[model samples]
Target: MSARDGLDADERHLLVVDDDDRIRDLLKKYLSRAGFRVTAAADAGQARKLMSMLDFDLMILDVMMPGEDGFSLTKSIRARPGRQTPVLILTARGLPDDRIEGLALGADDYLAKPFEPQELLLRVEAILRRAGPRPVVQRRLSLGPCTFDVERGELSRDGKPVRITEAEAQLLRTLAKAAHAPVDRLALAPDATDATGRAVDVQVTRLRRKIEADPKNPRYLQTVRGVGYMLAPDE
Candidate 1:
């Protein structure tokens, strides 16, 4: 297997929301190098925006921020519809009640500040392992005017070949394999080095432009809130 295959075999995507620039940057760098995809946000506002666009396997939230603290944010995320992406709250305050509150609000785990990076990594791995593996996917898909062959990694629209970049082809194949199921952005990444899953997002946009009548409001290539992209092929 290649190095990328060995490193973060699952390619889980993580979101780190913290007001502390130093902390956020450190976590992003550390997590990225460790083989997992990481995205950082300065505050709840930025986190919400990121969450709206990308699907994350886990979220690391710093409990104290200027607006909408981690606790409140966690509550809001759980209240939202669809999959509740696992949340790991980080706080300087190590109070038992704080941990209880976070858990009650739907957080999967809690880590106090000044934690060892290794411990955090281990916790993340444990949480994901518990989240379970993605379901098996179908081999073929029908997307309105488009038909995708997962094994061949080919897409055709209206009985005509629709040219796609190698990157787009790979992404389509991944999504096709998991048709009707949410595929995490990181899992669809062309390579392991795409730690932020930004490359995957770009490819999805291009694919939507070609497949959807209106890319802005996609029907087949849909975003599963708090999860990732799902290909809703015709039955």
Candidate 2:
């Protein structure tokens, strides 16, 4: 297996370097909601500072900045003694040569500007998935009357195992990672399936049956109206 296959969704850290304030903030918020710890930098200088302080899993860079453009910084990163962090470059320059230059400078992937956030997310996932599989850390999450163990893929209440399907376990793991935050249904199911939104709703309903004391009025797993589902684990 390639190094990318080892990366798990949880515990992935990203560094987003962009000069545009709006794009930087938007990507930061969006990726954070998607269950990744994202740190933003306004330019190459700030990116260098952050890189010196932290070890990031991946980086999202913009090419056309005021100074020290993405290509130069990518080349510098590649030249570093032991820095092989995956990089995905974003720029308004859509020329074939521009993409070639970015990739040649050690970028793992490149996307032109005016792209959909969903598409950007898919690219990020794709790049990270290629790195390698990450070790699965066992964690026990509290949900009012029950405890869900991520490593064992088991849920128990009052010392008894509560039967749950594999799909349900996967859904719970995804939600538990971002507890108290709304998770988009599209993030839950990325495949081109018909009526995916409705399908996620069905899955949520089934999950409620196993966890909620009253499925009609859930306590821990609550729907955020037009947004999506949020897991408010018991404190």
**Residue-wise C-alpha lDDT for candidate 1, range 1-235, written one tens digit per residue:** 3213433534678899999999999999888877888899999988876665456788999999997899999997786544668999999989999999999999999999889988888788777777776333456688898988776667899999999887787777656655678877876652347788888888889999999999999999999877779888899
CA lDDT, candidate 2, residue 225 = 82
TM-score of each: 0.61, 0.55
Error of 2 at 134 (Å): 4.8
What is the Å distance of residue 235 in model 2 from its true position?
38
Number of the top-ranking candidate, with TM-score as the measure: 1
Error of 1 at 181 (Å): 11
Give one digit per residue, the lDDT tens place, for model 2 in 194-225.
55578778889998888899999999989988
Candidates' C-alpha lDDT: 0.81, 0.81
